[model samples]
Target chain A: MSLLNDLTGAPPGLPPHALLLRLAAIGAVLAGTTCGFAYVGGWLSPGALTPARVIDRFEQVNGPHPGFRRNHAKGLCVEGRFAASGAGAALSKAGLFAAGRVTPVAGRLALAGGQPYAADAEATVRSLALRFTLPDGEEWRTGMNDIPVFPVRTPEAFYEQLLAAKPDLATGKPDPARLNGFFAAHPESAKAAALIKARTVTAGFADSTYRSLNAFRLVAADGRDTPVRFAFVPERAPSPETAGQAVQQDKNYLFDALAAELRQDALRWHLVATLGRPGDPTADATQPWPADRETADLGTLALTGSTPEAPGNCRDVNFDPLVLPLGIAPSDDPLLSARSAAYSQSFTRRAGEDKTPSAVAGAPPHGAAL
Target chain B: MTPSPRFNLPARLLHWSMAALILAMLLIGVAMVTSLADYHALVSLHRPLGILILVLALLRLANRRRHAPPPLPADLPMWQRRAAHASHVALYALMLAMPLVGWAMLSAARYPVALAGPLVLPPILPQSPVLYAGLRSVHTVLAYALFGLILAHLGAALLHALIRQDGVFSSMAPWRPRRAAPTLRPEG
Candidate 1:
């Protein structure tokens, strides 16, 4: 017993590899890149959550914007520029710009679980969301889902579908017949539904795609107002065999993969707005931008050092169509209007609930089945 | 009177290992309560780990009671003995309190506990903002109290090793008394 005890005490700590892992995690948290133990990672401490840093970091990436104001006390204020301001279209024109690069992007991939939905696993269809912070302190938030379309058009409809799809009050799960009827009734969701049906399902919170259903006008160099759809296509589509399989003890596969790729290869995106070509229909995401193959813009976005995360430059800077400048205005689609309204509600809802601990996001419609 | 035997090696090991984890956890916990943004995940990670510590601490106590530890020095003063026992008692009680308080806080906060991967821990307490706020305060204060107790323990151990030249340091020391080990024999 003494010999056995002696051997163990000599080590007197967590396993060697475990210790290394802890050190690595601590290092990453300090660096503000990896979300350590926390499933959602960003700023660690409140004092560290300063608006000045967020703005400055944005300025550093996108270039100096005189319109951007930091009053040393009023948080952060930035004036909007129409997409056509095409003012500083190139890197040279912009003072602190990274120029067309998509370097630093944090991707969250999750599934659309259909039941009690309390845990992180059990559904599939890859939901991907990413936010970009240009050096000028300008922020862009892009949310996309794997499927091209979604189940509902309006926020009100969305709410209704979710409530109907939620579990039966008595049984505590979705009624199969009710679920089928709900899907059948909403044939408009056929595109998304077909893709979802064929797609191999994975971890609920890990395997899903999120879409920006409403049309967004892409203010091209020439200031054209054409309807466009944006997506967060997986950089490299994983094998179908990899579908629905959560790695043992791996809490953050998507994050880990994204971090490695950012470190290894430069990230790029196709910033194609609806061309609104003669044959194409106007931008109405509710009705698909009339059959133009998604074009590639070859814009480059690189993360210089820190992550452009929430409340950071990208997150803090408001990106509502209501606030868009003269050139890149929101299209006149009812769904677009509804999205703006719904997203506004979600934003305010999220913000308000965030203040109190009881306001967890696990509420009905989005999270827990109720 | 007969002296009790020293704690079993496994029990002693779990004891100190948990001690380190608790200290580190307390510091991180203090940092976490302030940063409300990512607080969810931190709170989630913290709850289960705290519960694990509490259960482990309880088992340690039961084991110790069943298999009492070796006795203190015969020459030890009454005051020193009292201090040692009191500090240890505080540590164990705190080990139990912090986690239970955190669990209650989350229950009030209406947050579900995702235990070790997919297993969702049942909420042991009902939702009550007032109770949650109070429990949160209790958890924080107890953490500070725990820190104070740890410091006192460390200071006393150092005092025994350096100034008092006594046997207190041997209480949790990993070494066993050997025949050739030096002792503070009185000067002639």
Candidate 2:
């Protein structure tokens, strides 16, 4: 009787308590259906609400050359220029550059890979580098990753991370010795390294949520700053007990499943930034921000739109942290600062096609966000 | 008694394998560039392989031209034939264009493109910051363009393999089943 009253939109004759229960049930059913379908199909389908709908969904994302990439190589011949922006203007005249946002940004993200085409299941943590030009014409970079605390800290350590993961000198195999150095040198990395190692040996994609162990400084309009780290909490749950058993059966389980999920629903991360405050733990890229310091909910990050399905898996979409808008800036944590330059160099090296950003690179003061 | 004008084994291997590699390359390229720098060596391998694909794609195209493709299926629609022709042209055009643009962009930026050996590829574009930045974006823009074209290519290939089940797929089939081989292989 109470359930019946809660439904029917709670007519004046119905008791308030009864009406409330009915409404709650209906809401629960509707949400459950969406969640169920989300697992089946929503994860892969790129809706108008998709996180990365960078192209023509809303008017805000739309810009002068909506889908254009500024041609640096072409401008080399014609405009005597190398800037992506300048190339865009020149190409627009020649009917070359297509419509895209004027203030272009670039981003790159990746995980540590040992074999050239090794299955992603192997312990591979993620990386993101973004670069954006501000309204004031200044550029800011934000370098981040999926692990909450990085195994290496300073630029020197970052360099060592490269050597540790590099090919062996004698046998041309991945050097196991150097790879173990950081783990041995800093016991703190044992925690980060353990998480990384389990990812390789484990199987459940649901129970596994990755983190960027580095801290970033986000400056707000009120002159307040927040030191933050990134984590991508999985939307679905997989049995932790079965995670190991599943890995033996399927090596590429996480990647393959994620690919299917992407086909259904856009992967979304609630961009929550942990603030460094008097009440919070030290906010340093070298130190893992405690779970308790979780502060502002930055925004939601999702696959906006993929012209081709599984873009990061199947397209040329680079998701570097350096690709930024106006306000977001990278901090002075030596690793974050070095990544900006390193990424730009790596990106330029990776792309053999066309265009370079700027020859003269600059870094801002990192004590706080700009 | 006649050999099908189908691509020679090496040509076919290069064709189909490279098609797979290039597509994989693009995706891996996309993902690698977006990453925060966990594996620099893997990231390092991306470019050399891209340039390698560029070279291999060129050689593959040249071989494709040298040895004519098997005659079009009698039932191939007129539109598909034209599309087939145009798509091949575009594929070759992109395969050739993308690397050069990358090389030129690199040249403009003053970076040496190591072409898988001690020898370095010559910089096609002179050093100019204004030109370098523009070419780099153009390089990236072309990268996206290459991606779009590759998607179209994939759709066509999948259609031929799954829907048509025609000889069209044989051009790049990893191992064309001998006429006597049974079709009991499990699905992907």
Candidate 3:
């Protein structure tokens, strides 16, 4: 009893009545701290969808390819320069849009799945991620994909899609029923898939148009902001043989063709910004603006050289979509922040893993003259 | 020389300011990990705030060396005194280690700790994925441990003020409690 008293009771000098109050206060503090721990530890809210959880789901689906991105694992690096066309100055005051202003760029071209060794033919969505280093030490990094619009609107729906797409152990492909259910639930995704399917696959990455599916704000010098969606439109016309028709027997056919194209001469793409009206949906990536929206030629991106993925200049870059320069800012696009978070998590995970050298053959060394 | 009955002005100021800052850091750290919408803004605030805490911790340690804290009440139990000492040591260790470990984790991941415009802290450790993963885990565990210690410290301080009325809490409190008699000695 004395031991219990000592444990729960007030100190020797304090009155007996004080014990109750002290016990209550102590209980309150304990309860408060318990709640704090629950909140901070993410226990209070069970099954909460978090960035870490999303990345973890990617790992679960992809089966742990170390030292590679959680998504778009198979890739090759490219280096070049972005030359401003001067036309984009009217839309925004970004230096990259200033006529004659040229900036260095390190970029990665990759397929959309998490399998680093997946066959080139399996890739339906191709991606181009670039980091443009400005003269003032600021950077504008963007991750663009060939798709006209993203499949989902919010991160939660994206997570649902990821779960639905998880391959079954027996078939090694996403269950058709689950996928159909997902598409049925998310009509936006169904519409996007239809639109993507309607477009013909380009002969190679060099001829493909890479789009910023999310909208962003271009801040003018006068502090006015213009909502815009942009795309890197390839200068090369699509070859007669479409990518779907020309799926070669080689597993790395897409990357090989890109390398071969780069060897002949530098490839170029025009940066075109599609201005948005006041009523345009800045928050939804799945919705595209009307085809008649005005566009401004921002600049030309020239791919002067290529490198293998692992040792390349773009190896360590996260290419976060939200890393914009002073004159540019993210729109209300919910996907932008989600993309940044997921990219950061992916970068952190891959940074700790032993990087397997990319299987992309016959690429120039890391610092070859651009 | 006899120690002053109350904490020195610098010590008091540092204690309160650091208390506020540390609480804010903990909240920001949790928010950064959980919320995507506020992650960027929180990160911009988190990096500088961590460095500030680190600098203030160093200054507080140095001040503590030069001027010792007022002695605890004589009536306090031996175990309680020992716990107080141990918890203070752990608190100080975390105050120093959390930022250093966070900085090291970022360094290991090759992340730039941008403090302000044109000011970035150089990486303190070589970039290594294994080290980053380990340090990141350690930092998180220590944060929870620190939270627990703070709760205990607060509970003890309340005990001193409300029940014991021993002037122990008033020694470091920003304002003196009316019931704390000036004649109360270190030996309660």
Lowest lDDT block of 10, candidate 2 chain A: A73-82
True contacts kept of each: 0.00, 0.02, 0.28
Error of 3 at A333 (Å): 1.6
DockQ values for all predictions?
Answer: 0.02, 0.02, 0.40
Top candidate by TM-score: 3
Docking outcome class, model 2 = incorrect
lDDT of 2 by residue, B48-114 (tens): 8778888898788777677767666665668878987898888788788877777786566544554
Model 3 per-residue lDDT at A126: 91
Model 1 stretches astray by more than 4 angstroms: A1-139, A168-173, A199-211, A220-223, A234-238, A241-244, A247-269, A272-294, A302-326, A353-370, B1-188
Better of 1 and 3 by DockQ: 3
Judge candidate 1 against the unseen true structure and give its global Cα lDDT, from 0 to 1: 0.46
Q: Which ten residues in a row have the lowest lDDT in candidate 3 chain A?
A: A1-10
Q: Write the per-residue lDDT of candidate 2 for residues A1-370, one digit (tens) a residue.
A: 5455333312345566645555465456545634543443225443412112211122121122211221110000000101222222221121111123233333333334322223444345444333333333233334444554566555555444555655565875557777777668766556666654544322333334455455545444454555555454544453443445545744444434444454456554443445565544332454555556645443333432122112122112233343332224345455543453344543343333333332111122235543
- State the lDDT of candidate 3 residue by residue for A189-266, as single tens digits: 888878876776777788989999999999888888999998999988766335454454588888888888888899
Better of 1 and 2 by lDDT: 2
Residue A18, candidate 2: C-alpha displacement in angstroms: 99
> How would you encode candidate 3's per-residue C-alpha lDDT over B1-188 as one tens digit per residue?
77787899999999999999998898888877876666777777988999999999999999999999999877567898999999999999999999999999877765667676535678799866778878988988998898888888888888776666667889998985667544365543
Model 1, span B34-97: residue lDDT tens: 3323333455467678878988988888888777776655555678789878998898899888
